[model samples]
Target: MDLFLSAAFGFPTVLFTPMLIVVLGYWIFVIVGAADTEMLDSVDTGGDAAGLSAVLSKAGLGRVPVTVALTMLICVAWFVSMMGSIVTSLIETVSTPMLWALGAVVLLIALVAAWAVTSGVVMGFQRFLPKRRGDSKHELVGRTCLIRIGEAHEDFGQAEITTAGGAAISIPVRTTGGEVLSVGSTALIFDHDAADDHFLVTAFDPALDPGQH
Candidate 1:
């Protein structure tokens, strides 16, 4: 109550107040189903997926999604600012120049810490996430599956198909030529696009894909 307000609205840490608000707002949207993790991975700056991945890898944030990186950054900002407040408060008469220098150092530390945290978190979750087996994906080629996400774009999306064991496997998917499949739509995976590491899914038609019929 009082402590939260003090930390959030007080000096130094108050700089991250807006960031906290934004992060919280994003999670709220995610909870209510207005948004999803795909938004974080879909920011394109006129580069292909491989180029974007390369840039992210060079930045030490390749494994972490953009939203996860941003969330970790905001958390680090709040932590560093609060730490600065605690340390600065102990000083009897700190000058403005000295305070600025300390702030700069704290910001640098925050940046490094945020990157480390993001990497660590992504690695930690990797053990629990399912990996697509090369052999299995090859067999799924030309199989029809249901699109589970909001929309399956040519770049990134997900599809769901049930297995013999009654377990539903969700696989990352993509298409080409500006094709986008809405949620609940059926698609026939034509080929395994190895370059993009996703199944090249096409709209399913009864007459077209006799294998499915």
Candidate 2:
């Protein structure tokens, strides 16, 4: 047990100890229902969450939450730390500065590798995971939505909708006619755009659209 502790707290592996601890503690919090509300709301298409997700969405990780992304990073760091320790252990003797330098380089490489692996997993999840309850995307067509971003264009935009569970969800949206939709605008999701993979929205007025009710 002492040997195991020494190895874990030793040079290279020690670098990732902090991250591993965080990951474990985070899960514990989630299990006990003490998870952060901020994380749950990150998947929202509006507000600052959208900006952060825009970069991740470009990287194919938009579906993944920030907490999950962070967890991935920590998991990869722990794995890399263990690998580094093994490699360094094979060496006879090394100077303190050299070890630190090696750890720094490993940190850079680990971060890149972690991002790749995390994004890959997130992409995979999008293909198989349940997106909206048990309903398929096709079933969501014709639903009404509220624009949640500054302006929703054919190119970029987001909207909020209420689910059968009475939970509000934010999702990507686009105009069917390439029109611009301002924040808080009401729209009817007429169809799904296959090319862009988002809902095609049309201007809707509760007073004018009889189908709104």
User: How accurate locally is residue 171 in candidate 1, as Cα lDDT from 0 to 100?
Assistant: 75
Report the Cα lDDT for candidate 2.
0.69
Give, for candidate 1, the lowest lDDT window spanning 10 residues: 42-51
Model 2 lDDT per residue over 138-194, tens place: 766877889996899878888988644334677788885669988998988888777
The clash numbers for all candidates, in the given order, read 0, 0
Best by lDDT: 2
Model 1, CA-based lDDT: 0.68
Once fitted onto the true fold, the runs of candidate 2 whose alpha carbons sit more than 4 angstroms away are 1-7, 10-15, 36-59, 130-213
TM-score computed on alpha carbons, candidate 2? 0.51
